[model samples]
Target: MSKDYPALTRDIAQYTGELRKLVPETMHSFYALSRAAGANGRIDAKTKELIALAIGITQRCDGCIGFHIKALHGMGASREEVAEVAAMSIYMGGGPALMYAADALRAFDQFDVPAV
Candidate 1:
């Protein structure tokens, strides 16, 4: 069997809602601290998101990568941008990076941001 993403699936809405409940509070904690460190004044939001994506990949958190990539696009990151940033994770993480990057890439479609 072959697997691909950006396709229709079952049970996604439940998972999506569940993710919403957990992710917002966790993301806000980081966001609050980032702002407290004057990160709000220094780093742009998109860049921060890319940084988060990289970190998620490094940590091998499939959920983090998936959610952050979705968040990145929601913040206006493009597919090429996501692809570009995730590529660097390749050097930092090796094969695991490539694999997880694709998982993150799926967020682009799964989140209804439309493919770019």
Candidate 2:
């Protein structure tokens, strides 16, 4: 079955907000770590997002795949670029990664559509 990535991310965000309220200090630290990791240095933001996407695929985390793909889409990542990252993830992670990689590509396509 196909997933509604946009809706999935939205639901995740809603729950994440609740989690943040319960553990504001931890959530705040996590946010800071995320920001610092994603910050541009030698690597650009787009490339960092691609790396995150690949990691998400390998880890088989649907929420990570959805969020990272959405970020890549917002950064103007091409389908080809996402596919290349998926390929790399599959190579490193074998069959399980292959499944999540496909989901990641699906997430990319989902984000590609213009909202009506």
Q: How many backbone clashes does candidate 2 have?
A: 0
Lowest-lDDT window of 10 residues in candidate 2? 107-116
What are the lDDT scores of the predictions, listed in order?
A: 0.69, 0.95
Quote the positional error of residue 18 for candidate 1 in Å: 10
Compose the digit string of candidate 2's lDDT tens values, residues 55-104. 99999999999999999988989999999999999999999999999999
Off-target runs (Cα >4 Å) in candidate 1 are 1-31, 34-39, 113-116
Candidate that scores best on TM-score: 2
All candidates: TM-score: 0.64, 0.97
- Clash pairs (backbone) in predicted model 2: none
Q: What's the C-alpha lDDT at position 111 in model 1?
A: 64
lDDT of 1 by residue, 1-116 (tens): 22233342224546656766889787568657856653444787778878888888877876566657666766878888887887888789999888877776776656654556
